[model samples]
Target: MGFHTFDIDRADALEDESRYRHLSAEELLAVLRPHPEMTVADLGSGTGFYTDDVAPHVGHLYAVDVQEAMHDIYREKGFPETVETVVADVASLPFDDGALDAAFSTMTYHEFAGEASLAELSRVLRPGGRFVVVDWTATGAGTAGPPTDERYSVGEAASALENAGFSVDRAESRTETFLCVASV
Candidate 1:
């Protein structure tokens, strides 16, 4: 794999509520501020775990995952009508320029963090569009998520977003994770 991808065999684990201990639905919505009129995309939407949380709040959601099998798992679980399955990489999305009103990723940033992917996100989001990222931090103790060596720090993510033409509004580190809010 080019990056650390989630295994579809463990798709059931993603639906567990305990997974929210790192980043809750409340916190994600608070930062994403998804509205009934907003069109959003959930990048690296594994099994639509978090996608199911945000779909109801947004007018539309594109559940993007590199693995089609993940989407199949989500389909079996049933998702909101607002949710649309999209199989694509973050580096290359099938959307027009400024197509999304807002976008977010949960525990998936490390899998897609790069200049090309970040720049693609910047290209797809409208001006002033918000992009919230919650992922395992490199500074973590390895209790949850990927190994420290495989993760990126908040500073690194912030810098990459900035290099991709995003203005980071908020960047903070939690015990084992980081939250970064960047605007296009």
Candidate 2:
């Protein structure tokens, strides 16, 4: 099971630009390689931080979050024309089968990592669709993000994706985080 959901009061902290130090928008875009015609989702898109960065690059961007308040915060900031807020859980998405060309999550893998969520993601993405995940690793120093005990190592995450029938093409464990790119 995943850890607790983020405190809504701390939603403001999610807008901090310094968070790029953990997972840069450039790195995420490179991993996704999104095209202007590709449909994508920003899973757990709180405050639409990285979602905004990816919206203009994709045909449609779904800012999915379990918390409607997070979407409310995003609305206050403004949404891209192509971006739509979806109040849903990763384990039970509202999208149809093979509806997405790609999906990515920034520092949110731990909060929604599980078999049900992975299967839902696999169900929504078409064949050869990409799924990029960047999150604080279990092996990290615990100087930032969640507690180390609540996180997953890159190997563990890779195994989870593999079990979900995803072909992991790229996986890297950085100083404090892990980046895993998989395709259905």
Candidate 3:
């Protein structure tokens, strides 16, 4: 019954109200049909609200976050040129290997702890590239609310992203949230 202690200005003020206004950044960019040149990544990227609308449809993004006050709230709200605010550690992700072409996390993966953020989302994606994964949906038993063992579901996050190699796609338990897409 503990470990609820946030600071980065109250977690960037609970991500500027209603937890970043309960997703729908144009329906997660229409389920990430993104491809303006692709290079996304947003693991726990708070306060920037889906990295400023996924940084004008991705040619770069990497808003990662351990929270240097959420990169000073994306440098006091001035983001534009394909973003780059990395404080990182969604259980350890820096980048490069296949070097991301897609990645995401809304509702921040139930505050992670499963297989170390699914092995850092299978080591920064890009074998096939795509890993959407939104969270919060256990309905009852604390009702998808955090602090109930840091909540998680969607079949335990798609079986912890298919045991961390990730190839399990499409898992939508949506509405109160739990969407998925994976590959790598």
lDDT of the candidates, in the order given = 0.93, 0.94, 0.73
Candidate 2 segments exceeding 4 Å error: none
Which numbered prediction scores highest in lDDT against the true structure?
2
Q: What is the lDDT, from 0 to 100, of the residue 77 in candidate 1?
A: 86
TM-score of each candidate structure, all chains considered together: 0.98, 0.98, 0.32
Positional deviation of 10 in candidate 3, in angstroms? Answer: 2.2
Over 47-131, each residue of candidate 3 has an lDDT whose tens digit, in order, gives 6777787789878888887767767867887788888888766677877667887888887777654677677667767688888
Better of 1 and 2 by lDDT: 2
Superior candidate under TM-score, 2 versus 3: 2
lDDT by residue (tens digit), candidate 2, 55-159: 989999999999999999999989999999999989999999999999999889999999999999999999999999999999999999899988999999999
| All models, RMSD in angstroms | 1.1, 0.9, 14.0
